[model samples]
Target chain A: MTTNHTNHRTNSSGPPLIQCRRLTKTYKKGDNTITPLQELDLDVPTGDFLALMGPSGSGKTTLLNLIAGIDRPSGGNLIIGGTDISTLSRSKLADWRSVNVGYVFQLYNLVPVLTAYENVELPLLLHSMSAKDRHEKVQTAMQLVGIADRHDHYPRQLSGGQEQRVAIARAIVTDPTIIVGDEPTGDLDQESAQAIMDLMVQLCEDLGKTLIIVTHDAKSAAYAKRTLHLEKGRLIEAAVLAARRAPLVPQEA
Target chain B: MRLLPFAYAVRNLGRSPSRLFLSVAGAAMVVLLILVAGGFVNGMSRALRATGGEHNVILMGAGSEESVERSEIEAGVPGVLAASVAGVRTRAGVAYVSPEVHVMLPVRVGAAARTTTQSSGEQAAAAQGSNTASMSKPKGRQVMMRGVTPTAALVHESVSLTEGRWPVSGADEVLVGRMAATVLGVAEIDVQVGKAVMIDGRPWEVVGRFSAPGTVVEAEVWLPLADLMTATKRETISCVVLTLDPYNEETGEGADFGDIAAFTKTRPDLELVPMTEREYYGKLANFFGPIKIVAWVTAGLIAVGGLFGGLNTMYAAFASRIRELGTLQSIGYRRLAIVWSMIQESTLATAAGGLIACAVGVFMLDGLAVRFSMGAFGLMIDETVIGLGLLTGLALGVVGALPPAIRCLKPTIPVALKAV
Candidate 1:
C-alpha cells in the first residue's frame, strides 16, 4: 500500500469549507419515492456568498441543510471544514454545527419570551464562555446589527424588520464561519426584505463570512456573488457574479 | 438549558388567561377537598384518644373486654384486689383506685320552650319555673352521668374543679362538666357550691363544676358513687380504675391482672376483667374507625379523578403548542431540555393550586368545631396533610407533563420543522 502524497496535497489545496460530492436524499411517500437531491455536487469555498433559487419542490432548502449539516445525505460524502460531517455522531454533529454554521429562518424563530439580548446570547451558552463574555458578545452583536437599542424588547414587541435583525444578531453572536438562511425574507414586505438581504450581504462581504441563502425572490437572489438554480432535484445552472450586482431600489428599501 | 424554556412556558400559559384560571381553579378545588377531609378525620381521632387520661388504668369484667360501660364487677373486689397487685403506685401509702359506674341518658336544656302558646316573656317565665322545678324532681332531662368515688379525681388528672370544690365524702352532691353546664344553661348555678340537680325524682345538690383535659369529659355529669347507684338503682359498679407502680420498680410481686381475673374463677362467686386504659378506649373508639376509612377512600377516589383532569388539561395545552415546541427544537434545545421545561411548568401550576388549597383550608376550616358524641373537637389542619397535598401536586405535574413532552420530542427534524 503506497502512501499517496500527491492525492493528499490535492485534497489540501481544494479543501472547500463545505463540499457536497454527488450528495443525494430521498423521501418515501405512500410507496412512491421523491428524490430531493440527485447526485448533487457542490463546493462552497471559504467566505463565499452563494444564493440558491428554485421553485417550491426544487430541493433548494434540502441542499442548504446538507451544507449546514442539519440533515444527512443518503449517498456520497459531506465534508465541512476538513471533517466528514456525514460520519459524525448526531451529538457531535450538533456541536460541530453550533461552532461552524448559524441558521436564520424566514419567520425569525426567536423564543417569544426572551428579550433581544438574551435571544442573541443563546448559542454562547452551549460553550464554556463566562457570563461577562456572553453579555459583551451579545451587546456587540446587537450593536453591529443596529438593534442594540431594542436589546430588552421581546420578539412580539419588535417590528418585522427589527425582529429579523435580532435574528441576524443571534446567528452571528457566536461568530460562526458560515451562515445558512432559509427564505430569510419570505414573510417580510419589500422594504423589510431588502433590509434583511442587505444585512446578509454585509455580513458575508464585509465580515469575511460565508453565506448560503435559499430564496425564490429574484430581488433577494441578486444580492449574492453566485446563484445556483436547481430543477427536479438537480443543479441546472451555476453562475458567478459581482457581490453587489445593483443597489436595491430606494422605494423598496 | 437555562431556565429560558420555563419563562416561555409561563408566558404561553399567560397567553390565554381564562384557560389558565380554569385549570388552576379546578386543581385548587380538589386540593381543598382533600385537605378538609383529612382535617376532619384527624379531629375525630384526636377527640377520641383525648378522653383517656395518662394516669388512668381501666379495669373491666373478665369475659367482657369489648364494652367497659356494660362490664360489672363487685364493688368490694376492686379495693381488695387492687391492694395486692404489684406495680401499684401510691401517693401517700394509699393506692389510687376508683370504682366507677358509667351510664348514658338523654339530656335537654330546661329552657327548651314548654308550650307553643307562651310568648318570649311567658316562655322565659316557664323556663325559670322549669329550672326551679328541676331542683325538686329527681330526674328531669336525662344525661350520661358517671358515678365516681372521691379518689376517682386522683386517678384522672384531667378532672379539674373550675368552681366550688369536689363533692364531700358520702354527700349527695354532683359535679357537672363545663360543656354540660353550658349545654344545660346552668353555668352560673355554682354547681359544686350546693346548687341542686334532680336525678330519678331525688334532688341532688351540685357541689362543683369541672373541666376535663379534653372534650369527652366536657359532655358528662359526675356524681357521688353512692348517689349514682341509688339514682340508677344499680347495685354493681361498671368499671374500676387502678393505679400501678412503674413497671421497672418493685413495690410487690408483678401480678398480671389477666391472671388475677382467671384466678377468681375458682371462687365461683365473682366475675372480673382487666385491661389497660388505652386498650379500653381503643375498643370504645372502634365505631369511628370505619368512618375514617370511608373518608380516606372517598378522598382518594376524588383525588384520582382530579389527577386525570389535570393530566388532560396539560395534554391539551401542550398539544396546541406543538408548533412552538418544534420551533424550539430547530433552535437547538435538546429534547430533554424541552421535557424538563414542560415538567417545570406543570409543577408550577399545580403547586400554585396546592398553596391556594392550604390558604382556603386555613381561612375557612381551621378551628371550626363539629359536635360528635355530644362533644366537640376543632378541625385540625396538620402538617402531614399539607405535605400529602404538595406531594400529590408534584405527582400530578410530573404525570401530566410526560406524555406531551415525549410526543413533542419523538418527531424528526423535518417533520417537526414542518409542523407549522
Candidate 2:
C-alpha cells in the first residue's frame, strides 16, 4: 500500500520541508543482520506536526533519528530543505544540523553539569554571534517555555516537567527548520507528560516550526496533527490516525 | 569546529571527586618519578663535568690513563714538568704543580655518639676491626682519599677552606669535603671539624672542611702529600696535576696544554701521558652512561604504569558520560570537539599535579646528597629537571585521554544515546 498523506498534511504554506524516498537502515546484531527501516516513503511539509508510533523494534525512533540528521540512511534518499543530508560529509552534516535541526530526547538530555540557562544556550554556541545576542536568544526561548524563573537551576535540581521545558527551550533557541523528539514524554509522570505535550503543541501552532515526535503513548500521539504507525520495519498503511481519539493505555515498549 | 565551553571540561572534573583525586595522584607520582630520575642523572653528570678545571692538565703514567688510583708516576715528575714546560702557570716564582696520591681505602667515622644512619650492612662488616669495637663501630665505608701538599691548593683553584686550617705535611691531619659525610655513610654532624676519622686504620684529626660545589672532589678525603704516602707505604705518586696559562699571541708569556704534552713526548724515560683534567673527568662521565640510561628507563617504565592506570580511570570516566556525549553531538557538536574538551579536562587535572611535584622537587629534593661509588653529589633539581617533569605531566594528560575519548565516541549518536 502507498502512503497517501493528503489529509495528514497540516500546513500547505510551502513545499515539503522533509521527504524520504525508499529510506532504509540496517545493522549487524551479532550474526543476524537486522533492518529497522526499509524502502519507506514519506513527506513532512513546513510547520507540520507529525507523530510516529510503533512498538519496540519497529523503527519509530530510527526514523526520527534519520530525520533529525543524527544518523545516516544506508539506502535511498533523505532530503531535508532540498538537501540530501544522507550524502553530506560527517562534518558538513554537523554544520547543517546546527543551523537546521534541534532535537529533544526522551530523558530530557540536558547536560547535568550545565545550569538551565547554560543548557538552553548550548545550540546557539555553534553560531557566530556576540555573547549579548546569545543571551537574548536564550532568555526568549526560556520565557517561551514558561520556565524563565528556573534558568539557573541544573537538570538535577528541576523536576521532570521542568527539565523537559528547559530542553524545549534549547531546541527552539536556534530557531531551526525542524525539531524532532524521541519519546519526549516517555519518562515523565502523567501530569508532567501532559504539560510537556502542551508546550510542544504550542511550539508547532505558534512558531510554525516543523515537528516530528516518536512516541509509544497514544495520548501523546493524539496531540500531533498527523500520526503514522509502523510494524516489522514497514509503515502500516491502515493506521493513519489524525486528531482522533487514540486507544487508552497504549502498549509500552 | 565550534568548541565546548572550558567550563564544561572544568566542571566535569568535579563530578566525581574520587576519580579526580586518583587522576591527580597518578600524575603526581609519574611526574615525581621523572623528577627523581632527572635529578640523579643531572647531579652525576654535573659533578663529573665540573671537577675538571679548564686550564688544568694531568701527568699520569701512560698505561693508567683510565684510573688515577692505579696510575704510578715518578715522584720527580712535578719538578720535571715545571722545568720543561715553559708556559706553566706560576705565582711568586713557584710553578703551579701538585704531586698527588689517589687511593680508595676503608674509612671509619670515630665521632662520639654516632650510631644509626642510612647505614649499609657491608660498611658495618668492613668496620668490624674497630679499636673500640662495641659502641664506636658505626660503619666503615670506602672513600676516595687524595693526598695534596700546600701547593696543591694552587693547582685546584675551586677548593677553599671553609673551617679550620689546612693540613701541614707529616702532621697526621685530614680535611673533609662538604659531602664527606654522605661518602662515609654517616650523618653530616659525624664529619664536623675537630673530629678524628680512622683512615688506613689510623686516627687522623679532621682539621678542616672544604667544598668544591657541584664537583666530584667535594666527596674526597684530603691529607698532606707526605702523610698519605707514608700511610700507604708507596714512594711513587699517583699523578701530577698542574695548571697551564693561556699563551699570548705576540708576547708568548704563558703556556698551553700542548706545551706540556710536547715535554712529555720529548722524554721517553718519563713514560707519562699529558691529559687535560677536563678530559679525565669527561671520560668518567661517559663511563657512567649506563647508570643514566637505567635511571631514564626506570622513570619511563613507571610512567607507563601510571599511564595505564590513568587509562582505566579515564575510560571509566568517559564511558559513564556516553549518553551525555551523544547529547552533545546531537546538539551539533563534532566528535573531535568533544574529544578536545575531554583532553582539556584531563590536562588541567594533570598540570595541577605537575605543579605540585615541581614545588616539592625544588623545596625538598634540590641539593639533597646521595652517595655512590666515586663519592657523593647533591641531587640537582634545577630548572631543567623541573621542566622535564612538567612536560612529562602534560604528555600524560594528552596520551592518557585519547584512547578513552575515541572509544567512548565510537558509537553512533543513536547507539550512544541508548547507553545506560
Best by DockQ: 2
- Report residue B23 deviation for candidate 1 (angstroms): 4.4
* lDDT for each residue of candidate 2 in B1-420, tens digit (9 for 90 to 100): 899999999999999999999999899989999999999999999999999989999989989999999999989888877887788888999889999999998888845223322123335776755434454455478899998988888989888889888987777899999999888877777788888787765578899999899998999999998889999999999999888888899996888887888888889799999899999999999999999999999999999999999999999999999999999999999999999999999998888889888888999988989888899999999899999999998988999999999999999999999998
Fraction of native A-B contacts kept, per candidate: 0.08, 0.69
Q: How much RMSD separates candidate 2 from the native structure?
A: 4.8
Candidate 1 C-alpha lDDT tens digits along B344-375: 88777887888888887888886556556545
Give the TM-score comparing model 1 with the true structure, all chains together. 0.78
Docking class of 2: medium
Residue range with the least summed lDDT across 10 consecutive positions in model 1 chain A: A1-10
Error at A248, model 1, angstroms: 30
Candidate 2 i-RMS (Å)? 0.6
For this target, which candidate reaches the highest lDDT against the unseen true structure?
Answer: 2
lDDT of 2 at A43: 85
Candidate lDDT (C-alpha), each: 0.73, 0.89
